[model samples]
Target: MEHEPLPSESHAEVRIVAATPEVARRVAAVLRRCFASTEQRSYPAGREGGTRLHLTLDTARAAEPARSWLATSESTDQDRTHADEV
Candidate 1:
């Protein structure tokens, strides 16, 4: 699956699947440099739109320098569980 950037953050999406919480935290750290918060959302697979395992990075306080970094297409590497009525 291809990750798409958050509407809040000038179209930047980085997709990494099945990442452990540790990995998520680290990614969140990197994203924090660019965005304010990164949220994890999971979509069930094999359905319409296929499914999305993604993090939404919000750029509420993205300064000029951050914007500049975003303009460039640079890359890098990489979770959630809901228990009902435990």
Candidate 2:
């Protein structure tokens, strides 16, 4: 598959610090869904016992979808938690 380069103006970066590899992987999965097209790198031994993940996304394509997906996820999570309490 061929990937088109994102314009410099459409690029955004994210940095995440996770305490364990499992946590880092989970964070990366969320980012992957948010930005269908992304480039990622890792900086281990970053701060104390955490690993830092650097992810770059094309904002023009990723921003709106990401926001909508996150909002939907948040609502679903809240609903699920509410159901569990009932």
Q: Please tell me which predicted candidate would have the highest lDDT against the true structure.
A: 2
- The digit string of per-residue lDDT tens for model 1 on 1-63 reads 565333743445545433354555566567667665456665553333344356655544565
Q: Model 2 residue 48 lDDT?
A: 77
The model with the greatest TM-score is: 2
Q: Model 2: runs farther than 4 Å from truth?
A: 1-7, 45-47, 63-86
Candidate 1 lDDT (Cα, 0 to 1): 0.54
Span of ten consecutive residues with least summed lDDT in model 2:
77-86
Candidate 1 weakest lDDT stretch, 10 residues: 77-86
Candidate 2's C-alpha lDDT? 0.67
Relative to the unseen true structure, what is the C-alpha lDDT of residue 86 in candidate 1, on a scale of 0 to 100? 10
Instruction: Give the TM-score of each candidate.
Output: 0.39, 0.55
